[model samples]
Target: MNKVVCLAALAAALGLSACVSSSIPAPEVTMSKVTRGMSQNEVIARVGPPDRMRGQNGNECYQYALGKYGDVPFAVYFRRAAVVASERASCNLSITRATAGPGIVWQASDYAATRR
Candidate 1:
């Protein structure tokens, strides 16, 4: 009976530890594993679900909140369900064509870049 109680306590402790650790996001090293040509499902599996999603059909964009404060925005562009490009920046930007080098626009105090 004593052995059984001890095992139960140990199991409970490990379960609680797992729950606490999972609440924190994975490190940057995990995010770095993401690469071009990876599928949308693959990216989601690596980084978890995206915080924001935009676009439709062939052109799709998914934004994830990163960094210690969750302030850094990471955008991954998908073309035909495959990753074409990924960008990390202070301003949230979305482009229809991930391969295209579009102009970056800046406004006074507020930075308003191209978001589509």
Candidate 2:
């Protein structure tokens, strides 16, 4: 009986923690400052490195995992070291041929959060 009660309390605490985890906001990307003529290094300095890269050479897609679920990805297309477009992708979708991809970039409920 004591063990069951302790387990129940632990579970409730965990649930509450997850509900409140995102109360701290993510760092915002100053995307408006990123311009077409800037070099890839310049963009990275502002928007940070993307979660994934979809192409090679100076032309490539830089995908940043964002939105509510974090599984939502947004890509900034660059050609010859210049920005072409920046757009959010469909929910739970990728523009690449990857058979599998990463989950939410940050998950409050994951086991890793508890690690020292």
Candidate 3:
């Protein structure tokens, strides 16, 4: 019985660690593994799909807004199915694309959290 309880606790811990909450920095939320030449599907598999996808099928940018006080918005620009570039600033997130900014708009007061 004691062994069973310990195993269950371990499993619960492991499961919770996999979910990256909105409070966590975007880059820390599985973005470090993203690399050039990785297919869009791979990007999705690694970090989960972006909160917002813009542009068309081939040429697109996947944006994940940290929305926290000091987090720099992270975006992966994909061209022809692979990541081509990433921009540090100019981002937005929303319930729908209706109010989403076309690009990241980092304000002067916004600072990238250094440690994160």
Candidate 4:
């Protein structure tokens, strides 16, 4: 009886550990791939709708927020009818809102001129 109880306890411990490990979702931003001139529809299809949208200089900027993980804010810059640049600012949230600063900006030309 003691041996059976020990085996059951071991099984229970292993099961609990597995459940804990699997409960944390993988990071969401790793798969984000954006390019210039991709239409609003294309962006939606690839990354889903932005967490929020705002305007800048007559262009629309889509802000994709990564919740609470100190992940960066992905900003896609669109001008006229095409995407011009993409930027990501490493950010963290304080009590009520997110705080981010200037981040690396990747230009569309850089991505377009590359093959494969």
Tens digits of per-residue lDDT, candidate 3, 1-116, equal: 99999999999988887664435544565557778888889988987768777654445567776545545567777656777666554443222122222443333332221111
Go through the candidates in order and give each one's C-alpha lDDT: 0.67, 0.57, 0.60, 0.53
Write down the TM-score of every candidate. Answer: 0.57, 0.48, 0.50, 0.46
- lDDT of candidate 1 at residue 86, scale 0 to 100: 78
RMSD of each: 6.6, 14.5, 12.1, 12.7
Mind giving the per-residue lDDT tens digits that candidate 1 earns over 3-100? 99999999999999998887545446546867999998999998889887765453567778887678777878877778887777422333634332
Winner of 1 and 3 under TM-score: 1
lDDT of 2: 0.57
Worst lDDT 10-window in candidate 1: 104-113
Candidate closest to the true structure, highest lDDT: 1
- Cα deviation of 101, candidate 1, in Å: 13
Candidate 2's displacement at residue 54, Å, is: 1.3
Ranking by TM-score: 1, 3, 2, 4
Error of 3 at 12 (Å): 15
lDDT score, candidate 4, position 50: 78
Q: What lDDT score goes with residue 6 in model 1?
A: 100
Off by over 4 Å in 3: 1-29, 67-71, 91-116
Model 4 C-alpha lDDT per residue in residues 1-116, reported as the tens digit of each score:
99999999999999999988764223355234678777767777877787765542324566676544636567666654356666674211120011111332323432211111
